[model samples]
Target: MKPTIVFDLDGTLALGDGPISAYARAIATRIGDDSFGERATVALIAHAAGETSYRDGYHAVATLAAEDRVSAEIVSAAYDDSRALLGTAGATVSPPEGLSGFLHGIVEHASLVLATNAPDAGVTALLEEWAIIDLFDAMHFQVGKPAGLVPILTAALARGRVLSVGDIHEFDLAPAAELGADTALVGPAAARLEVPATMRGRTIADIYERISGWATSAPHTAS
Candidate 1:
């Protein structure tokens, strides 16, 4: 059985600044305030980048904007708009350096799966933009992390050794760890969180290289 590796899409497979900024812009635009958008963008990006929890930053921005009633509908609408923008003219997603080569090298030896909280369209657009859409053996989109990770982990276990890699300790790695999967934490935000992980790297490229080396040394038989 080929070793199974589950990858988080945003901030893990690609830089998330662009899309996250777009979400802030959408929220600001919806509220008809450019200044608010700028501030929200910073706060939201900080949250997405793992500086704070999503609820914390989101509520803080709402409060700062004097919005006493920040409903789920508003947040969802802004997120939907952001996804639309990313799929169209705002598409600036870029794969981590050397990711293409690394994926190609490990594809034959591993089963790669993409699991993300982002909507399907956004995930598809990013993967297509990066030209790695076909590399994944499976994909789960709009997966609410932590709780949403259960199904993904359950499925990957049947394939072989399961490993999860992402930039968020709570959303990406913690749940996977609960399921008994190996985990690799990537990026500076993850370092700041200082969660226990099987491996840690400053960037996705570092994690990729580490996994590649491991796969080489202990190659799995692909089913």
Candidate 2:
């Protein structure tokens, strides 16, 4: 069987200029707290993104803004509102250029799966918008990373080799690494995490190129 490549949706396959910071701003706006500025919001999000649960990130934000009476419920509401806004308004989020072609290049040699912390509807919408939904063989949403990766990794490993790719090292790559799967960390911040990875790059395109090169050079064997 071909190796199964598991991808994270938010920052890996989905390329964006500053969606995380933008999301932070939205949360701050919804909370109506002046103290939760974009910088602070970004910091909180970044910290949470590294954790096992997405809620941990939200809780951290609320705790950091306790002076403003920010609660987990409030943070949850803000996050929902931000996602709605991004989905309806077609915010700046988008897939990388030539995404379809990139996927096509590897589809024949590998099995593709999408695993994300985002809601299924939201991820589906984004992938549909990008016209690349068909490229994936399966998808698992709201899988709390670094912890919830077991089931997904177990399933993927049953098929063949596994390669997990994502932007955040701790949330996206660490669990896969622990499960003995190859990992590709795609962003500068990934370097901050002490996890071992098979590849590290600034963008999904870089990962694609590397995988493509490997596929081309790898030795072929009869089934």
Candidate 3:
């Protein structure tokens, strides 16, 4: 069977201009200013860092919003509304070049799974908008990249060599590497974290020349 390849959604397969901007705009409009929106984002991120678990992280952000009298229902509504608007308009989304062809070429030789920090509903909408949902074998959401992704992939695919393709080094590549999965860091820049030399076996730049070589060399028949 073909090797299982996992992907990060935002800033990897899809461009990164959806919910964040919408949230900021909504916050600004609601509070009658932009400063409050910025503060809310900063506070939300800070809250996320103090959590011990994924559920904790989610609740932390929810707590902040609640404290500010921001209704959870409203937040959820805004997210859905923004996603629907973007899906139909496609004005805010930028599809990465070569993504369709790349996926198409390897669809016959590999299993593609999307692993992302994007919210479940939003991710689903984005996939539908891009018309690429059928390409993936499975998807994991709001899990913050490869930190717990190796196990999820293992469970989904049974047994196979795993390779992760993503743009974020810390969230998308490092943890997968630590879990014995191959990693191809997509962007041109190096990671802020210091990757150990031994763990560097599968690193690659997001260039066609390099990608072609890696895809061809990794022998696997599509299941």
Candidate 4:
């Protein structure tokens, strides 16, 4: 069986600050605070310093919005709206450089899966727009991670070796690591966090060549 490679959509494959900034705007509008952007930046700094448990800038804004007494219902609405705006001028998003070519290059060697906590709001459109939609063998959205990732990894493990790639350690890599899958950590968090991952990169592009190596070198005998 071909090896399985599970990816986190938002921060991993999806690059650029546009979409997340839109999320900040949504939160700010809901919470009646124009300072959310600044606060979210500070929260991200604190996260890098280990002073906060927020996973990323998005998490920071969500937590701060909740702390500002915004209802969970409102927060959910804001998030949904933000995602719906993805790829638009309000929430522009892009894939890493040469992402389409890379995925195509590795298709014969590995099975690609997209697993993200985000709803399907605009993900499909974005992938289709990028012209990489057909590259994936499966795309699973709203995949509540960490715990929710257990079953995805379990099934992949039964087939062959698995590689999970994403930005957040706790939400993306931790569960996959626990299940004995290799992991590739991505984004700025890669600079500070000591995670249990087989590979680390400040951006997915940083490890693309290495990932190509892993994909091509697969023994295809793990199962």
Q: Highest TM-score among the candidates is held by which one?
A: 4
TM-score of each: 0.84, 0.79, 0.64, 0.90
Q: Give the TM-score of candidate 3.
A: 0.64
Span of ten consecutive residues with least summed lDDT in model 2:
214-223
Candidates, ranked, TM-score: 4, 1, 2, 3
* Cα lDDT for residue 41, candidate 2: 61
lDDT of 1 by residue, 1-223 (tens): 8888899876678764666666666667777778877777777667655676543333446455555344667767887877676645564567789998888889998889998887787667667767788999989888888899988888888666788888777888888888878888876665566467877777888767678755556432211
Evaluate model 2: give its TM-score: 0.79
Better of 2 and 3 by TM-score: 2
In TM-score terms, candidate 4 sits at 0.90
> Candidate 3 lDDT, tens digit per residue, 140-167?
8777454566567665446666777675
What is candidate 1's TM-score against the reference? 0.84
Q: Which stretches of candidate 4 lie over 4 Å from their true place?
A: 41-53, 218-223
Clashes of each: 0, 0, 0, 0
Residue 150, model 2, lDDT:
76
